[model samples]
Target: MASDTDIGSPERPTRPGRWRWLPGSRLGRLIIVLNLVGLTILISGALVLNELRRGLVNARIDSLTTQGELLATIIDQAATVGEPEPMMDGAYAAEILQLLSNPRSQRARLFDAEGRLIADSYWVSDRVEWRTLPPARTRGDGPGLDLNLSGGSEDDPDSADAAKAQAALRAEVNTALRGVHWAGLRVGVDGERVVSVSIPIQHVKAVLGVLTLEARDVDEIIAAERAALLPFILIAVAVSLMSSLLLNRLVAHPVRRLARAADRVRLARARAISVPDISRRDDELGDLSRSLEDMTHALSERIDAIERFAADVAHEIRNPLTSLRSAVETLGLVEEPAARDRLMAVLQNDVQRLDRLVTDISNASRLDAELSREAPTPVDLRRLISDVVSLYQATARLGEPAVTFTAPEGLETVMVSGQEGALGQVLRNLIDNARSFSAPDGVVRVALGRQKGQALIMVDDDGPGIPPENLENIFERFYTSRPKGTAFGGNSGLGLSIARQIILAHDGTVRAENRRRDTSTEGDAPEAAGDIAGARFTVILPEARR
Candidate 1:
């Protein structure tokens, strides 16, 4: 039960809650998707690099553990003393740890069974840790005046950090003293990340001390891995930028142009839309451009037709009004009885003509809306024509022309796709037109047949044929040209025009042609040679598919 406006207007429903926050424009959405794609790639690279970092850490731990175990075995054999309960010779273990440690990459430390730090490889190798001193305070005399030159000041931040590392190292040594080997990541004495391994120094099933090895280059290795992931991030960013630009140029901008063109049409700034560049593209947008242009063109043409129809109606109505006014004025002046009677007749005729013109104008104006409102279905031309001809014959007077119908042999029905009421009106209009032109006692033939996949309906009359020049003009609104002795104003001239309009709306054609007879045989009359018999109105409608 939708109204005409509801049916004709395009839908613009509100967006659902979940999608309401999303960008409404195509370019905005494209940018979001492209950036997300790049971010996904960057995240995937980070995940892969994370796995690599774990593998490197585990490998470093395993390498340090192997070295620590070997050093612990050597220290147990070479630096152990005492009888059944073995004791670690601190001095001897320190000498052995110094000879075996590689101070450039690793630091070796030894803790006693009491979990006390003993031999330190950094002190034994005399490796100096270099650092840049901070700027001197304004209260000091020189740049190094307030610097904490003492390595283990209680108030120093480095001292507090080193204390935490020492406590963690003590825990690892205690665990090793229990005869368990440990290797994993931990904080070094210098407050830097390192991979450390602790192995027990045992002799003859007696726990002596713990030997620990730490690799302080673990942070450097992770930094290098992160640096290697930079190229993938750059590539993903570049691709996202390129995709956004391409989409804006190829899709977003063209769609914006189409919208602007439509706006021009809606605002009445332009009669029709014509975007040649967009229409040339071989895509859906191109199709849309072409369709818009066609629709606007059709609307413009319809406006022009309506304007012309209004002007024609005004002109036709004015003529009758002028005549009626003149007749009324003259009737008042006329004195003779015959003159008064003639004036009365003229007034009546003018009134009748005006009424007929108004009725025809009303019908013509509503023709478009009626045709559009009624949906088309299969219509049998044969039955429709027969019914119209029968009605004319049933109402015929003795002096009127006889109406006859004929169809092709073996043709049961001539079916077409059209509104039954509209098509029936078309038949009625054509028959009435033909009867109006026919002479009394003459025959008007209504023929229906199928030709070339079309249902053909021809109405032929045995009257004066239409002039060749006016054949097309006869279908124009308010055009009437009657022969001699015909009653003036009896025909409103809208029947043929309305009939043609109806047929055109049904995707059919109607035309007036002169029906000619050939007298080329050996006849006695040569003056009747090639004579024009009468006017034939032919209607061709596409046949309905079975």
Candidate 2:
């Protein structure tokens, strides 16, 4: 079971793990997205081109099969001879093969029923097969190659390749002789890839020969498809590079500059962080930069204030210590009883002063901690002021000033948002200061009311008003300027200062001003044109919203 404050507190963010490196920074994420976009396009193009290549290969095989079937049928009808056991006429089939035109990229071959070659489209059409020959071997190129000089013999590489090609052709022809059509990819005699289709020539269930058609332009088609994909690859690469450069300029560099500025502050090279260029931007980074600058500035001010406070404490404590030392030394030197008694009285007064100063200093030092530790809540000013005045009335002595409280007519309470205890301490300090300065038999008035949108509490006393120039300085630490006839060493001067500090912590203001009265009438005294009546201390706090 957690309290509301604990439940609402934000948890600390966890650091990223080592394996999650891809999304570590803004630039890294941007680069991933940009590169992925290019990769997606390149992959899609490759997939489409692969499908096109498959389709082209299938279409080429089908076209060859159709052409081969028609030619086989024509040859079966025109060139088959003999009764019942019909056989192909090789001479006539050769003539028919020569008469029919084939595509330049395609070749047609014919074989007899005994698996013997009868005609070839390339030879019948007199189509010359052109190929680049390897360079002739020089006599000095190798040491032992000259022993086997014969070319195109049974032991030659070309002879072995030709024999292998003939065997594969016979195998294809043998399958067609069984009256089955075979169509697929195979290596041609020149070791180039081709789509080949074999069809059997038949005359009324009598097998005669086989005709095979091959398309040898598959490699060229695939090369063209690869060339078409080059432009997509280049575009994708260009997009990725441009995106990387843009991200570095827009996001990476500025963030780097901010990091450097923070390092400078941490290293004590600068008192406060200031990056005007980044701060001027209208974005979250800009807000962050400005916030850093403000935080540093505030911390610097607080450090300076603490230094000043330390110096002040040392100076204030020295005075009482000096007096006490002097009094102690004089009491031991005096011989007569009356003189020794006077020295003893001086010693006691110095001791009391030191005690008062120490106590006030301790409270002043703890003021900041107390204010920070306590949270603010709505406080009824009427009840707080009434309680303070009642406490003073209960402890009043003979001939002392009386404490009184007043609120706005018809208003039961005036509310402000502040720490109740701290606010009560502020009211008590103001009331005590007023009572100390008040004239004998005079009343110290504590008034609470609302003005505009603020809750105003004013403490007034019927005594000699403060000097106009010393009004602001009165709230400064250790600034005590009591009037004549006031008891000596009775005030520590930290009361008003502490009050002002508490009011400021609550986002309120406290100020001292003299109450004046105008006596500019015909019967009035001429010297009393404007008389200072009393000193008024007003504390203004923002009204708590309903």
Candidate 3:
């Protein structure tokens, strides 16, 4: 039994993780990745240095092993001369050790089978202790120490530590005396990396002595390897800088300019947006720029249309108002009963005219908004026209023109995509327009069919044909031209105009033309004397796809 509050409660939202500080802007994201290229270069350089260090140390060990094997071969010959006791010839061994000694950056040593130090290359050479001083003590002291410095202090604690480290070297030699070669890295008493290798001296399966080699300058080799990566680091930095510059110029700067142009339009400082530099580009940003321009232009046109419509409405309302005022003022002065009755009749007419005009204007104003609110569906034009015409026929008076709908022969339906209510209103207006001009006995005909993948509906009447010059003018708002007998202001001119608007909104076209009697042209029907018959209004709409 959980309460509604508990059940409906949402979980707390999690905050974004690291790297969320990156800006949401496109340019900011590009700049971040571009600059990270420099970091990538640093990481790759470090990896390359590490690999070089390993390779160089391994090569040093291999060289030491090779040199030791040659020296061990010579020492094995000298030590094997007294085999059962395994005694080294001191003079011969010393000569061999001296020839191989390298005291400046490397050391060579020889150990007997019993683990006793036989000879050391370091003792044979001149022992210059100042050159071998530890970096910590040397850097701490003054720089101008005597250049001829001979040796370290005999009682120095650091010197005693170095003697103890030399004893630890015996373990590596002893491992070789057990008949196995050894090679590895170790830190010396002076805190420098030493590449050590030891090989056993043997004569026909009898171990005699051990030959050992040490490369003391491994740190220098690693430093040189890092220095070699300098050029790559410089190239990466230059590439990153170039990328940032190009992105700012070609992408970020142009977008910012377009944003500023749109802001001007929003603030009404400019009538429309024109991001010329961005629009010239052939990309998505260019499409956005062009769309903004088109939207602003459309808004400007709509504003102009609204201003003109307001002026027309005022002009149309003023006519009826003036007439009503004249009729009202004259009613009090009319002496005869018939004159007073006529004056009252004029008042009623003007009042009715005002009502009709207001109603039509209201409908026209809301037409565009209402159409946009409703989603369009497939509308069957044949059925829609038939329904409207049937309603009219059902309510017809004795002298009113009869309404009829005709569809193509053998055609079941003609469909178009549009709002049903809107399309229905369009048909009703067209039919009513035709009826207004028709004679008492004339028929207002609605013919529906399809042609060239378009739905076509033609409203025809047996009324007087529209004058050719005024055919297009008839669709203009508040422009009415009725028959002589028809009462003034009986119909508002907005009907045809509203019909055209709704049709156009549905991506359809409407036009007016006169239907004429057939003329004889070699075996054709004979021409009627009057030539003109009645006006025909045709509408063409895109056909609905399956």
Best by TM-score: 3
Q: What's the C-alpha lDDT at position 41 in model 2?
A: 76
TM-score per candidate, chains pooled:
0.65, 0.60, 0.69
Q: Can you give the lDDT of residue 377 in candidate 2?
A: 88
Q: Tell me the tens digit of each residue's lDDT in model 2 across 134-229.
A: 457677765321111111121123335544555565677788989999888776556667788889998988788889898889888777777897
Clashes of each: 0, 0, 0
lDDT of 3 at 258: 69
What overall lDDT goes with each candidate model? 0.79, 0.79, 0.78
Q: Lowest lDDT 10-mer window, candidate 3?
A: 146-155
lDDT measured at residue 430 in model 1 versus the true structure, 0 to 100:
85
How big is the positional error of residue 125 in model 1, measured in Å on the Cα after superposition?
11
lDDT, model 1: 0.79
Report the lDDT tens digits of candidate 3 across residue range 1-546.
Answer: 112211221343334434445543345456756577656877687867665578889899998888888888877775467736666665678677887656477878777777666677766789655545444665655543211111123112345555544545767877898999989987565667889998988877777777788888888777766677667767867777677667766766666666667666666788888878788889888888898889988888888889999999999999999999888888898899999999888888888889999999999999989988988899888788888888998999999899988886888988889999988888888888988898889999899888899999999999888987899999999999887988767887999999999999999999998888765356554433346789999999999998
How far off is residue 213 in model 2, in Å? Answer: 20
Q: Write the per-residue lDDT of candidate 1 for residues 165-266, one digit (tens) a residue.
A: 766776787889899988888876567787899898888777888888888887777677667877876787777767767676777667767776776677
